[model samples]
Target: MSEKPEPVDYTYTPIGTIHSPFKDIVGMPIQPTGARGIRGTIEIRSDLKGGLADLERFSRIILLYSLHRCTGYSLKVSPFLDPTPHGIFATRSPKRPNAIGFSIVRLVGIDDCTLTIEDVDILDGTPLLDIKPYVPAFDSYPDERSGWLGAVAHNAQHAKSDDRFQ
Candidate 1:
């Protein structure tokens, strides 16, 4: 038998910070759809402001951020929309091996290094790892199966996060 591969450690620096209305996770919307019209701002580091060029052209952008508030992880979790515990990979639970979270939000406007965004569900002061233009052609799959989520996906629009993960 071949030897097992060793686990590797990775490091990433925050490129910016996400500012949202949510100061705690107790009553915040669980996803973008639930936070519809909610506005937020992304303050990019001054040195990285140059990267914002041409990014404003996209109507929506995907934000990859650190779930700084999550201290640990569980392989199976009870997501906001569903009470049934599911594998971490099958659900968008903040409790993960890597505390990373992402959201696709409407890009309202860009000013200097700050980006005005809407439909935000992330926590305030979350560390932004990166941003990418959201292209529906590359991201959407209308006919694909969402497995267990399909049954309760509609509930997301009305779901609010509780302190279960905390």
Candidate 2:
């Protein structure tokens, strides 16, 4: 028999929660492109209010969240954008050990501790971990390597997430 790895513990509390129209997993967009113009709001914790100051300076922000609904881990997965299985690191499959999610969304408005955003692909009530301004100059690229995703990025809008992680 193979030896088992030891476990380590760490703790994190959600700074906020995302509220979106997507209640069910079926038929929901697997990524932001498919969820074009879909609206959502992030309700940030009052204690973290100070951190959000000046966030309105940018029209877009990157949301880092937790896929609380997903559990477990897999080193290989058939991602929504492809048929053949690939390493988990090659795709944003939520069945990661950390269950983290990321999205670059258009900022609509900010009201107190809540932020209205668009192009949402995450599920409702997802835990918000952090947010950062999206600067195209730093985040955009003219040409870059996509590896396996290069072939399917064009069809990603039509891709729907299935239970490959579960």
Candidate 3:
């Protein structure tokens, strides 16, 4: 058997920044559901503006961003919706080996290199890593298990984020 390679550091220059009214982690929405109707703007680098071509064709988009403000990590975290702690990978906790965040947001409009979006749970000035059109036909799955989340989902609707992971 071949030997596994050693881990190496990786660096990514932000392609853009997500701007929102949320200036702090306190009182912010824990997930997209709680952030519904909240608007934000994406300022993409001028050189990458062309990548937005035909993006308007989709009503919703997926945002991949860096949790720039999350400082540390934990193998088990008490997710916003539940009091019991779960494996870090099993949760949407921003504190992880790589502080990357994902969100499915409504695309309101686009103007040049900027995009207007709604239902944003990301923090203001978060670094945007990538964006992809959310195709419901390919992404939907009615029969999926949510594990412990299933029983606690009702709490998610009203749960606001705090500095628990930050």
Report the C-alpha lDDT of model 2 over 82-160, residue by residue, as the tens digit.
7798888988888887888899999999999999999999889999888989999999985999899887787868777
Query: In model 1, what lDDT does residue 135 have?
Result: 100
lDDT of 1 at 107: 100
| lDDT value for model 1 | 0.95
List the candidates ranked by lDDT, beginning with the highest: 1, 3, 2
Worst 10 residues of 3 by lDDT: 148-157
| After superposition, candidate 3 runs with Cα above 4 Å error | none
* Model 2 poorest 10 in a row by lDDT: 157-166
Clashes of 2: 0
As for TM-score, the candidate ahead, 1 or 3, is 1
* Residue-by-residue lDDT tens digits, candidate 1, 25-114: 999998899999999999999999999999989999999999999989999998888778899999999999999999999999999989
Per-residue CA lDDT of model 3 for 1-166, tens digit only, reads 9999999999998899999999999889888888899999999999998899999999999999999999889999988887888999999989998999999999999999999999998889999999999998898776899888878777766898888888
Which pairs clash in the backbone of model 1? Answer: none
Model 2 C-alpha RMSD vs. true structure (Å) is 3.2
lDDT by candidate, in order shown = 0.95, 0.87, 0.91
- Cα deviation at 149, candidate 2, in Å, is 0.5
Model 2 spans with C-alpha error above 4 angstroms: 1-8
TM-score-based ranking: 1, 3, 2
TM-score of each: 0.98, 0.91, 0.96
